[model samples]
Target: MEQSFPALPGQAALPGLRHRLSTRIVSLSLGALLIVLAMISGTLWLSWQLEGAGAAINDAGSLRMRANRVAIELARAHAGERHQLDAQITGMDATLARLRQGDPARPLFLPDDPGIRAQLERVSHDWNQRIKPSALADLGVATGEAPAYPAALAAFVDQVNRLVSMIEQENATKTTLLRLSQAGLAAMACMGTVAVIYLLYIWIILPVMRLQDGLQRMAAREFSLRLPVETRDEFGMLADGFNRMAGELEGLYQDLEARVAQKTAELARHNRDLAALYDMAALLNMPNDSEALCRGFLERVMQQFNADGGSVRMIDADHGQLHLVVSAGYSAALEEAEHCMRVDACFCGEAASESVVLIEDLSKGAALSAGRPASDARFGCAREGFPGLAVFRIETQRTVLGTFSLHFRQPLTLPASDIRLLETFGQHLGVALDHLHLSETARQLAVVEERNLVAQGLHDSIAQGLNYLNLQVQVLEDAVSRSDMDETRTIVPLLRCGVEESYQDVRELLLNFRSKLAHGELRQAVEDTVARFRRQSATELALAFNDAQGGPPLQPEQQLQVLFILQEALSNVRKHARAGHASVIVRNGRTFSMVVEDDGEGFDPMEPAADDQAHVGLHIMRERAARLSASLRIVAARGTGTRVELILPR
Candidate 1:
């Protein structure tokens, strides 16, 4: 079995199976630390060497001073001033001894070179052999011979000067060597530091960065990505684990995607079902005939279910037979053959009788062909050569309305869900058909009621006008029989006037029955009416419309009534009042108001006798206004002009 490794939390797994990163880091750090320590040690050693060199140079300078003092003492002795001559000689000897062998207490300069030491030995021998003997002889006795002592001392001082110069030169050389060593140590330290840094980058930083990049890709759901496992370490194990996790996640995502696709297909099917039922409901609501509605329903069912063809068969209650009202995607021969059938003769009819749905696969030829003769090829649906059929009974709560049949080219067994949806569709179709039937019945009733109203109106207006003219004619005949010329002339005009008035009443009634407002616009119709009257009447007619707050208040029927009232008022002004000017004012506000006023000979409105000819016009206006739920007021006196005002609430 292969061992599995779990990744660490908050940090990537270390490469533990290979060289430990910590060890490498510690080694690099220690290397750097060692380099630093070596640099410090080298610096200290160089500083010490420089200090020693400086001390040597200073001692060599002191030796030169001692040599000069010896020369000076020799000069003084030669000049006969021998006061401290012996002391100066002793100091020169002591400085030479110190130069030859270094004195720790005085810290005198000494050279390590053999050549310088041999030169120093020769100088000591020269000093001791010649100059010292001369100086000592000068200090002890007269010896006033100026006995070559100054020349010997000068030679000794020159040798001491040469020794000091050699010591200084050696010290400068050592200082230069120390400085070079320090510079070399510093360069080595810097190079070591750079090498350690480069090692650390290769060993730790680069590997950690690669692991971090792999983690980022995983976080972003790039599961197909894999980290390179270049070592047998913790990072390598983590890469293996990451690859495993990515594989698992990829597998899960594929499964989830497949499930989502399946669900989407199901949702799409449900939506199509809903949309098909909605379209069928809309077709049923339309004012199409039964055949058109059936055709639309069949087509929608076929398209929604992917059927090759379909038919709707309605039962004719009178004939007690099934009739194919509409079909889609069927040959003409098949359509004609299946146009009509007995209630118990066909599959659709059988489904209608049973009031249940049936699904058939004709390719099996099992239950469908039971008890059928071999030579009887007159089957309705069989002639179509369909592989499958689904017949659903469309029925309301009270009655079975029809049968819906779908035929498919291939054998198909509908799922339970689809069957349930089809059944629901059928039920909705039945309900819609019932609603349409009720609406048609209501429409017929409305027509009958409107005809009754029209008949009543004719009886009240035109019939009354004819009766009045008949009475006037009887009076005219009586006047002619008496042979009274004046009475005859008066009766003739009254008779003629009655005939004209009756004629005007007939025309007005006809116009009222036939005239309809254009597009149901009350204002435009009123304007047209005023224009017509202005063209015909001698009375100067004016129309004023004021509807600034709201729109027109009256409905189409109410507007028509108002128009008729206006016409009656204008006719009265033209025939009876004989007015020169008349105006119609229509104002729409919170309430609607129409006023008709005329500047003419006004009559007493309060004393409108039943026999008055103007009374008929007033009656008609009052009746029309009452129908509108409005108030009609006739304001007039013996001399004042008449004003008819009609007001209705909005």
Candidate 2:
């Protein structure tokens, strides 16, 4: 038999905890208010009963006194003392009327009891019939025959005494009843107060204390604490809710701890992957031959994946063939036989053609190793003695570089994480190869451009000077052929001067080609050139550099070009422009500007004379400026000074 337990109180109660709590609070307050109101009503009723009893007692005493006074007045009148007998009679008459009408002033308090009314009626009758007549007679006003003298007084006193006794008895009874009612009400109110307090402690105060204790425990991270659910009320529902919340919080905290641990492990794994990739990149960047780089990369891959052997094979796009660049853990005969394969031949070739990773379980005896000639070479699976193989494509954005194949002795299954690592490694290798290729191409281009610049420089300076020297020699030859002695002598000195000038030009060209500014410091080079020009020329040179100490430094190539342009401008100024003041201003900012000005005999730049030596210098300066990716502007006139400006992007 399955034993069942009762459900916790108010676990699934309707209207929720808030509504139930409000209802309970309202009920308790109303109950307490009703009890208080009942106590107040009981006290008021008792007071009213006591007040009526006191009034009745006082009326009884007054009735007795009035009766005694009537008796005294009757006695005095009988004794011939009738001075105030009439006044006494009137007073007694009024009291009798009040008793007969039951004191109409107290309407809700009528003396309607038969015994008391009868007694009061008798007193009134006696006073009117016997006492009044007797008193009137005594006062010397005869209306009727007077009755017996003290008999009427004795009857009236007896009746008044009876009425007083009845009134006292009623007062005593009411007093006792009022006292009992008060005691009963007080006792009931006290008992009710005790019951309400006990109930409040059970339903409200105890639950509240328990909730407070639970909250304190929760604040201390004791999420397992719970309140007891004892009744189908607000407190019980609250306990249920609190227990549920604690359970959920405990579960969530445990789950959070688990997730944090899992994520930490994942992060550690990722860090190891990154460290390995960084090591591979450093190895690839070293100045090693292609075969050495491949060999090192294969070793790392084998170590990273716990594989037995691996090979890096590159695709010859033009030949449509796969050439094994490097290999590991293979016999010499097998390596020679499998060193190269066609693009569509085997698993590696398939990976290259499809540009996807390929896996093969050689233990299944698949056809991947087919079509190979049977020989002692033992190519493919037979040669490698590996049960499983994986081939990954090494590619970039659009170009397929090659294939990397790894062999495992046992049948291997790759997890997503390991597969992702392999893919990332392939990407890094492909990009590294591309960078090396680009670097080699750039080196070759740089060499070719340097050779072209040297050829042009020689043609512009040394070759031109030699041409002039040849013309001068031809003139000396013509003079000697004519036998003109004076002309011949004149031609000889001109020839000597021409030879010296050509030699100097050759020297200067060699110096210009060989000159290498220290670390390509354009400003220092400019200052040194200016000092040299000042020593060699009569012009006063002023150099100004504004905001040139900040901003990004220019590239080495750009700085060299700017230095060369400045040197050319100063050279033209020295040889042709006989200026007194020359200034060079270089400003470095978001853009670079170099201004070379001279106060000299300047010529129109737009239409320079064909024989002007400055023209060649200006052409060279413009060529250097073009290489700097800058624009050159020359402002010169016959009379005005010359200003050359070069603006380059920073």
Candidate 3:
């Protein structure tokens, strides 16, 4: 008893059947519209393209005709030059014939013959210095000047003939363009036929088919059905009118689309803003590390635009310098993408000067007005990133802090929304960077406070202890019996030694505490030390300093560490490697290295480190080297002598 009351459904089938018939009619009509529209549009577009192509062909043909005339002129010019050469040769032949005649009935009238002789000499000189030199390979003379240079002249003639043949070949190649035009014309004929067939479908066959389907569906009493295609001309106007009638019957079918699309746009905007906020949040958390934040900004810009090469160009407008603050790029694309400029010079400087964004197509465009575009290829993608590049300036109300750039391997237009996203990213990044700078300033203040506390503690505790100990030692010295000379002397020496060691430790501690002041002047100090040592030394010492600078300077701790290493090296040279001369060099650069060479008794450089006493000097040098972030090298042999080297990287 599943409910068997289905007999009334027979009437429902009438309505359903009519609906199906109407749907079929509408489907066929829409299909006819799409098919005919595509054909008509494609045919018209292709015909227009072909017309432009034909015009271009005519222009090319005109150029070809001009080139052919130019070739003929070249032929004439060559012939004229040839005649001039031939006349000189014939004149020479006539002179020889006269000389062979041996009719020297006089001095051959030497001066009278001078003019003719001079002409021959002049031709020969021109050939030797100019023509013969151009035909040097076949001259058959080792020297540049050669008489009777038939070999060279023959070579020149062969070259001219080859050139003529090459011109003929070039002309033949150009004739291929005309053949192309013929092929194009044939193609045009076929295109016209396709265009006519397309027009026929649009005007007649498709319309008849649509009318038949519409009448059949109407006969089924499906008044809700109508033609689905709209048209533009007379036929289109009729079709559109019919479609409007259909829309009336099919009420509300496409109405929901507009509302749904608008709703989607609202949702997408929220998501985009959310994503941007999340990116900004990550930067804000890393307040102390400005470099990380800057890199993050660079990475986001890279991600947003798919950049291949980029840099931070800092503002330096006051002094004409667009310093490349920081650059990131791939190794392979370096030659194309690298931005190398002195710290005091770059387009970023101008950008900062005017406070504007600079965009350039280095491959195609020239520099601009608001800022400098140092051939945009400076921001070009590596082999991996090259199709194009883009730049953005990071700015705020305060000033133009710097510029950023984006690059892509292919040309692309960054959409308006994308540009807005980039601007937002840059603005937030600039703010984050500003925060980082403030944090660093705070950190420095904290460090100063701590150092002051340490200084006060040293004065109140360690110094007072030493003072009290000194007073006790003085009292002990005064009370000691002078007559018990040996005992008094022993106590005095021990006390004096203790005092001296304490003084030395205090001096070292003070120096270490003052390290912050030496920002990047280590090499100058090291060089000064070397110079002083050289002044005292009797031997010659040559320096090859690698000029490393602008990096964080060596702290007082590091300086002391390096000083100990030098002392150990000098001591080793004095005791074990006995020699008459020595040289110490400290070289520095982007990376620091040093060599202390001496011509003394040499020993095997590669030896066991466990032999502590034999390598006492080595141990001291290496220990000090490790503390200074340096390397110590001992080069020695049994007889040839030894060279000690110490390299410190600071």
Candidate 4:
């Protein structure tokens, strides 16, 4: 027999219910499946039996008819043979006696009696005494008919009579079998009717009565109602099982009654816990100011968990040590100073390092393990750390942010209730941290974006005005040269140089503000820069840039840094390393290198220029390079010329 069982809760109940309700259902369903199979098999068997019976009956009838016809034809053949024998045995007087004894008026066929022995004797004499035996028979064979012909007629008549009698008897047997088949069919029909009545009582009425009673009782909340155990068969089993289930249901009803109130209390407690967890998470996630959040969360945990003390400790990621940050329910002195102890010495430290909760009994030398006596020091005796505790690791994406521990003064059984509550709080705290991180990022981005907008505004507006001013100065100078434009002539030489200087100052302002003006390809922007430089300086400037198209495009802020470095270096070349022919070549070797080489009176590259010297441009260039994480190298010797190189990370 196939069997099944049911699964219970993870924590074992250890109940001795051998047959669970689920097993009952499975058993019943399987039995039903087997019953259906039996029914189908029985149906098929009955159909086969009936079909076989019909076929056998039809076959028997056919055979009986064939036998009757065969027997009748054989009898007729024997009769015809007897008739042919008459002519050969015409003088046989025994034939008349045999015919008379066989009832000729009624045309009945019967064997000849002893009174007809004449024919037998005659036939024997014809074949034996009437002639010279074989020699006489051979002579007769050459003459006429056989001598024993009349004797054969008696045997032929007997054979014909036997055939007719056998035929009649075979027909009578067929009639008896047909009568028996009808009687058997009637008996089967009666049996089938009785079987149906029994099935209706067992399958329908009895079971329905039992089920109705159970339903009525269940509706009345009398869950302990039971049915009678009638037999050990399926119906009996069903009754016994139903009663057992009812008993279980009664117990379940009671359990539900009690559990409802308990669950209501539990739900209320969970809600409170949820609120507390949310509050703690809010406290933890408020700010990345680790000191404040840890302290606040630690205090809340101590109070919320109803623990004697709590602390949030951080682990030494490298040394595998622990450091207590926020501790509550301890001496203010210890908590304030942020007491330091090796992970091996501190209780919380050791607990965190071990990655387990410490539940000390605090008997004998248990407190002395930390070199503290096992008595309440506050009560003028040694006091140990909390008796029972739980430690949880505060872990995040990159590092174990810290560990939090709750300490109970007494040995407390830490229930799953509090554990789940605390874990949910921890999760919410983690989410809060993520939100804070996003806020910080958004703030930083806003600052950067603000700076970029400010830079662009100054470039587009102020720089354009300066460029126009510089062009106007040049136009004034050209007009003065072409003709005596008196007013232009008067002001041109006096204001011309100063105007150009003013334009240069504005250009410097624009460069600073326009650093964030990137809206297209970086190299194309660089090309534009080169073109602008050539236009502004109005000198032969050899510009070359290698890999200018390939470096990760610099941010607008980084672009501003690059532009400043360029401006400062080029300004220095113009002022100190003066050369008619100059080159600004951007070379990317190990890093991005920009070198401005000019042929001019050279100076020591390492030493600063004299106080009176015009190397302030160089100083500014170096400062800009420092800000950009770029290296500034000044190569200048007496008359060989100079090269100012600015290098930034690739």
Quote each prediction's TM-score: 0.49, 0.59, 0.33, 0.36
Cand. 4 TM to true fold: 0.36
lDDT against the true structure, per candidate, is 0.72, 0.73, 0.53, 0.56
lDDT of model 1 at position 248: 78
Error of 1 at 207 (Å): 3.0
Worst 10 residues of 4 by lDDT: 373-382
Highest TM-score: which candidate? 2
**Candidate 2 segments whose C-alpha is farther than 4 A from its true place:** 1-19, 66-166, 169-209, 231-237, 331-337, 346-355, 360-385, 438-650
What is candidate 4's lDDT per residue for 200-256, written digit by digit as tens? 676557877888888888889989678876544455556766787788789999999
Tens digits of per-residue lDDT for model 2 on 1-650? 32223555645544444346566777777887887787678767655654554555465556556656656776665566764656656766765665555442452232446888777777777777876676555555343546354456676667777887886677667667667867777787788779878978877899999999999999898987777777766677678889998888889888989999999989998998998889998998898766777788899999998998788889898998789898887768667887887766534323334443566566665423333222222236544687677777777886878878788888767776777788878887887777777888898987887666666556655676687778878887887888878998887787687677667656655655665754537767777778877876789999997755575767777777787788778877876788999999999888899999999999887784787444778777887888778999999999788999999976
Model 1 has an lDDT value of 0.72
Clashes of each: 1, 0, 14, 5
User: Order of candidates by TM-score, top first?
Assistant: 2, 1, 4, 3
Q: Per-residue lDDT of 537-638 in model 1, one digit per residue for the tens?
A: 788888899978685556777888888888778767766777889899999888989999988999886674666544767777887788789999999877
> Which is the better candidate, 2 or 3, if ranked by TM-score?
2
Q: How do these models rank on lDDT, best leading?
A: 2, 1, 4, 3
For residues 1-650, write the lDDT of model 3, one tens digit per residue: 11222334312112233223344445655665675566556555444433433333332233223323333333343445332333433443443333323233321211123433453344345444644344333223344444333434444334333333433343344345445555655675577567657766866678778877876775674557766455433444445555665565445435555667877886797587668668666755655465566677677667655677566765555764455555566554463334444332334444243332544444444334354545434443423445455566666657556667665656546665676666666666667666666678887986775455455435533565477578757766675734566667766766776676456445544543444325456566556556644654454556565555544445666655565555446545544566667776665555556667777777775756454445545655676677566777777777676676666654
